[model samples]
Target: MSTKQIEKSTTEIQIPKDVKVNLKGSMLQVQGPLGKVYKNFKKIPVLIQINDNKILLRKTGERKKHQAILNTAKSLIQTLCTGVVDGFTIKMKIVYSHFPVTVKVEAKKVLIKNFQGERAPRISMIKGDTKVVVKGDDVIITGPVLTDVSQTAANIQLKSKVKNKDHRVFLDGIYRYSKSKGIEE
Candidate 1:
């Protein structure tokens, strides 16, 4: 290919001081104080390099496709590294005026019972290695992966959704109160 037809870009991601990153071929493994995470870039059209505490992503040719892959890889690598170090937390509270709601965590699933006085229990899925803790009326979802934690929280909130009910009148369901990095001590 001619140089004029090729596109090129370079992205650098700095590794955290307390985190250790290992790259073997197209797979990346990051270990930190909180947990370990793995990411694969095997099919992506980009070059990866690791030196000391930095990671470099290089893209050449194919315009936007290659550039997008490069940016995605860079972002995923950074997110995994940061997640393994600081972790992610999503806090939610159960709100019901008519009937009390109860939440229980079982394996990779969560059961929400008595949601708005519904006889059939509502179910939500817990993704990856996420931990769900039900205390009083508060539901706390936590994990090393941001996607897993956030998705789990979303699932729980969505499952308790009311249909055909006025949102202002029926403020009953699990709702996210706060989202933050790092676990509560």
Candidate 2:
């Protein structure tokens, strides 16, 4: 088999003062005023280097798949930096096909009720600092960091996923419409 060699690009990004990063193997642990986060990239053929003021990720090898990995790594690093510095947020909407759904936040958990006409409410685990609020049909989830916020949103959506049913007919699920910083949903 033959492989193609491609030129890699180096992107320079500034790290916030509050954030601290440590690299061990393919795992990168980042901590900041918002929270602490860890990202593992075992399959991505890349090198991560942290400097006094910036972090660099370089792609190695000749496989075309490395291009996607490189981009993903870069994005993850960017998100980490931003999240540590300012933080990330995700907003979602709860839609119902027939029954009206209601969501609320209690302590560190999100309470979901009336989903699919169920009598029992479903609870979504939430972090301590993260805030979950409900207004009409919109459920707003916010966190000091990106991973926690995104994971909480994903859990809500996953819990509403219908099984053995046509999605076109049953579209009652939590849907993401937009994100902070102008990122597409």
Candidate 3:
């Protein structure tokens, strides 16, 4: 009996007009009108290639683990492409039932002053290359990378989380309302 090997799984993504994808060894960089995003896939068990205006990602074997990684790489590359072009943004709203919470961006940290009438300010570190802006009751987080932008927003939300109290009664925290770049929940 002759043994047959399964074909590898492949995924293709079309590149946009205003975006440029550069592959240097294992590092992939995408630059576009919005900004640039870079990621390393050296340790992943997958192959990435840019052909013309398309991106090809494939796995050598048909194992479950390899397939998972292949899909992850594909999604990451697609996110990078979208981020570089349209960019990523998260909108958060500050709501306070009792004490008004003041948000400020200081250096690489977000300072939450007078949260729940606390004496000291709660600090949250900004991750990656994310930019945070406070306008009245609205908080805008923007970045070329989706992960960084979302993480930074999450950090702010977590920092102002209400502890040891009823969430319904004490609704004084920063909450994410919307997310852009084709990613929303």
Per-residue error for 144 in candidate 3, Å, reads 1.2
Mind giving the per-residue lDDT tens digits that candidate 3 earns over 1-185?
12332334777889989999999999998999877778998898888889999999888676788888988888898888888777788999999987888998999999999999999999999988788889999998888898899889988999999999999888899999988773232
Model 2: how far is 168 from its true place, Å? Answer: 5.8
Instruction: Single out the weakest 10-residue window by summed lDDT for candidate 1.
Output: 1-10
- Evaluate candidate 3 by giving its C-alpha RMSD to the native, one decimal: 3.2
Positional deviation of residue 101's Cα in model 1 after best superposition, in angstroms:
0.5
Give Cα-based local distance difference scores for all models.
0.87, 0.75, 0.86
Candidate 2 local Cα displacement, residue 30, angstroms: 2.1
Clashes of each: 0, 0, 0
**Per-residue lDDT tens digits of candidate 1, residues 96-161?**
898988999888889999987889888899998889999898998888999999999889989989
- The Cα error of candidate 3 at residue 16, in Å, is 1.1
Lowest-sum lDDT 10-residue window in model 3: 1-10
Instruction: List the candidates' TM-scores in order.
Output: 0.87, 0.70, 0.88
